[model samples]
Target: MIPSSLRARFTIIAACAITVALVLAGFMLTLIFDGNIRARAVAEVGDDLRTLAANARIGPDGRLVIDGDLSDPRFRTPYGGYYWQAGRDQQIDLKSRSLLDFTIDWRPQPPTGNDVAIYERPAPEGRRMFVLERRVVVSRGGTPTIARIVVGLDQGELDEARTAFIQFAASSLAALGFALVAALWFATSASLAPLRALRAALMEVHLGRKTSVEGRFPDEVKPLVDDLNALLQARNADLVTARARAGDLAHGLKTPLAVLTSTARQLREAGQAEAAADIEGEVQRMSRHVTRELVRARAGVRAFRRSHPTPIAPVAATLTRALSALPSPRPIAFETRIPAEAAAPMDETDLTEVMGNVVDNARKWARGKVLITATEAAGAIHIAVEDDGPGLPGDALSYEIERGRRLDEQVEGSGFGLAIVKDLVEAYGGDLTLTRSPLGGLKVDIVLP
Candidate 1:
């Protein structure tokens, strides 16, 4: 599933809403504008009809005639795009020359009473007309005569005006949509700027390149950054205390361990070989434990001070080279497989010590072959060292891991190697596991998070 961002979703919804509102408003305005133009045309035609009716007169032969000259320039010229005609018995008597010699195509029937008829009709000049016809009684010498007057105004000019308004409205609406989208883009970017800065700061922290976040952030996000910095500081202080304690503990044991070694050497000189050998072995075990603890303590202090990530591949390769330089008669074959760009959250010195110890232990017990593998998985780094030596005894492996426990009373070295591995792993928030290898030997698996 693709994740959606708040800024993008909000911008899209807002733009759509604005566009819908503008469209609705534009439609309403277009209707109102067209209706107003049509209404005014009808009103003007009605007024012209009234004027024609008022000027109606009856001649001596009972023929209808207009009292005033209908030849007023207002009537002669189509100044307002209006036309009119008045007649009796379906015969034209007077008409506006604004028609340009093209008569208004209207048939006005003699009215039954005093009713007026109003409707729309086609006029000359390819325009529509709003027509109003009325019947009037003209009295000459006390005799009443019926006459008809029809007046019309052209609707084409109104239609043209409405079309222009619609075009302008469409253009305006298009411009508004573009402006809205542009504004939304800028607003979204501004709102998300803080998140971007936070991400950059996090990257710096991850790489150990920066100890603190720096930049001005919005009020809402400042607290979050502050909390992160506080957490990092607390962790660093705790690590410092742990290192000091480990160092102090190691220092306190050195005097007793040195005295024990001296006693074992003197016994050997006095020719009590059997007793001296036993004491020497015990002394060596204590010395190894103390040394391992010191290394583990220092590893903790150095893990956070790395200026750059240590690539595991080159470290493994370097270990292979160093081991190959040892003049061993066992015909040992060293095999290494590591990724091209695999890295771990460890300093170079710490990594060298960790890898060297594991590999050296493997070389000691291996009959003919050793293998080293390094890879990354699940947000952690894994390093495995295997040797074709007699696998560790089950009971002995368990006891050796117990604090200050040794499996072999006669073993020539401190049995604290695996325990040191465990301590270093824990210091880095990682894990170390020992298991039987497929080559009928022991496999050391280290995972660093």
Candidate 2:
């Protein structure tokens, strides 16, 4: 299949154009050189015919005769492919010794505007000849004799010259065409270099290595790079604005909620304890929703905007210490197993939020022990928080994790913890899995790249 690529198309076009132009040029040069060689051969033979005709004499024997000194020795050598002949009245003739008893098929033409005719004909021994012929009048003392003088030369030398020229010209032109096409390839690659660099920059942005494309670019592509950078800038600005709005809205509702909390406490002291407690419970639920909304906004922005490595050991240690100090009816042991340098590819804020929620949930349900372990595998970091408690029914494990579906409504909190952790984990391009723990309870595992 032909590749749908810019480089391939350009190379094919250049090769075709160079090949066609060189082929035509080579043929034209060969023709011109061949014509000149043949014309010179014909002209030299014409001179020989003229000299032979001028020296011819009608002797007392009444036979055509010629005695002349031709410069070329081939004229006197038999079958030398150079010859001269003279004939009259369709009878006997005089000819060069090179004829070797073979008569030229001679024909006479009436006097015309042109005195000489030049053409080609086949010769003895399968050789081709270039012929130049003229009609001449030889007058010795009185009567005139009309004679045809023809001179011929073998075309072998001209053919050899033409073949040699064609070979040299073809080879030279082929080499020249190759060099030019190679130069065109280098020029094309140099011109397209900027495009390759631009692609690398874009990939870096996508991988969260950089936020924008950088470096100088050619005029043709500069506008596209500028527009892409501008778009990233605008997106970041919009995220900042949105996050500020969420923070403001969450804080704005807190004051009214505080007033309601105060009023509910007063109602409890005024002999309406049951109704007051219900009001406090609803208030707490609303507060959890508001807090989770803030977390959601922060997770969304961090996931889309940027990424960095977050160390797992320190964050896990901090959460373990905080949860360990929390008051409980029974002593709860918090154990951490993490590699000191292990890190996950995620924002620090996101990693903290997710791990905090998972570890906090384990503390609530754990009977006496909560274990947090972190490890690296398959180019990702995995953090598992396991707890020992009365485990959920097999079918209820997934159901209880749904937002607001607490295993026990009698428990004193809204049920958005696991759901929020799920959201934050997904935002960081990671996953959260819940399964039966080896500790005889639930295991919340987080995998992040």
Candidate 3:
């Protein structure tokens, strides 16, 4: 099966193209070789024909005579892969013994002013020969007589030569094609090296190891790198503006809330208890909303780079130890069973704060033992903090992040409500699910993505 890869695709295309070209070139070479050899054979046989014409003449009795002899020894040997003949009025007057009992296969043509017709014809024993024939005017002893002359050689020799050349060309072109494909592979790897480096730089930026993508890239990739850097800069500027706005909003609202608190206290001292309580309750609610928005406003891009991998084991162990050390009306045993390698994409401080809330809540309500077990699956971290005390019923469970209501006024808190955990978890794109614990207590399941 062909894999879905660029290099594989390129190599396949190159190999196919090279194979097609080599096949075409091989066929073309064969034709060219065959044509060239045939032409050469015709030219060579023409020399023999000219020799036969020059050595012939008509005697005074009107008979053909020969004087000169061919230099090729094959003419003297019987069926020696070469043959020749001379004739007059389509009758044989002289012939080479190499023809044996079988004459050169030919058809006579009428005289046409030194024109020669060369062609291939079959000989004895399934052999083929190229024959060159023409009618020449022979004059000797002051008398002229027209005689037909023919010369030919075996076509098998030209075929053999063509076959040899094709074999050699096929092998040579195969090697050339292989070398070209190999070279193309190396070139492709070299060309894509820049992309791999750019990807690494991008990974570093994504992991928060670098503020922006930086590298010496090729011209084709440099523009993309520049665009990424520009985008990073723009996003950084926007985050700075947002964080500043969040800070300003927090600072601006504190004065009014503080004044309201002061006004509530003044009302209480002046004997207006109901009014004071209402104003204080409103102030507290406003404070919670402001805190939630402040965290949210600083949230958008701030978490992008700060959410480094925080190992759950160490944080969970630390929280369990601290919560266990705190004083409780009844002794509560804290259990921690987190794997060492378990980690989440969260800042250390954020994980500590988030886990601290859940663990402390469990310790506060846990009657005998509190269990904290964390596991990871499906690209998320699941941390469940369970207490063995009386768990909240279905209706009493925390179904909302904020309602300005209290947690049944049964247990005290660190003032950082579950709403804060939910807001923070959601900001980092995690979850907070509250349910009944298996140990007759509440279970807080947090899934951080």
**Among these predicted structures, which one has the highest TM-score?**
3
Give lDDT tens digits, candidate 2, residues 200-278: 9986775577999987899999999999999989998898899999999998999999999998999999999998999
Higher-ranked by lDDT: 1 or 2? 2
lDDT of 2 at 107: 57
Clash-forming residue pairs, model 3: none
Rank the candidate models, highest TM-score first: 3, 2, 1
lDDT of 2 at 161: 89
User: Weakest 10 consecutive residues, lDDT, candidate 2?
Assistant: 406-415
Span of ten consecutive residues with least summed lDDT in model 3 = 399-408
Per-residue lDDT, model 2, residue 87, is: 82
Superposed Cα deviation of residue 242, candidate 2 (Å): 3.5
lDDT of each: 0.77, 0.81, 0.81
List of clashing residue pairs for candidate 1: none
Clash count per candidate: 0, 0, 0
Model 1, residue 433: distance off in Å is: 9.4
* Clashing residue pairs for model 2: none
Cα displacement (Å) at residue 65, model 3: 6.7
**Number of clashing residue pairs, candidate 3:** 0
